[model samples]
Target: MRLSAEHAHLIRAQALELAGAQARVRLYGSRLHDHLRGGDVDLLLELPSLPANPALLAAQLAGRVSRALHGRKVDVLIDAPGLKQLPIHQIARSQGVLL
Candidate 1:
């Protein structure tokens, strides 16, 4: 993983705070590969439920991540219950490394 210890710690902590204790986080995309470089952190947050204003929540999470990373890009994808199934979601959950 390309993430520094601080990065990983902040990510998990932020996920817990943004979602809940029961929430699970996964790391995916180019950042997960050692040979790859200069890509944003791709995170999958599996939550029991989703907020009504998910875009606002995502933006808030982005702000938190940006502060921690000192402006580095972070992509947060929420996997909420009862959402319409999509192939991208399947790929993310299946291929992503659980954190």
Candidate 2:
């Protein structure tokens, strides 16, 4: 992964703070490739239960994580019990590394 240990820790801390302790986070996309450079952070946040507002939660998490990373671009995808799974979600799970 492209993230430093500190960056990964910040991501995990922020995610668990917002989504609760049971939430799991994964890092995927270009950031996963060491040979790649200057790509946005792509995260898959798996929640044990559905959030009341998935979109808002995603945006909030993304914003907070971005700010924590010194304004680096961050994209978050949420997967939860009641939400419909998309192809991207499958790809993420397959390619992602746990954070």
- TM-score winner: 2
Off by over 4 Å in 1: none
Candidate 1 structure quality by residue, lDDT tens digits, 57-92: 667777798788888888877789776667777878
**What's the CA error at residue 25 for candidate 1, in Å?**
1.2
Q: Report every candidate's CA lDDT.
A: 0.81, 0.95
For residues 1-99, could you state the per-residue lDDT of candidate 2 as single tens digits?
A: 799999999999999999999999999999999998899999999999999999998999999999988899999999999999999999999999999
What's model 2's lDDT at 46? 97
List of clashing residue pairs for candidate 1:
none
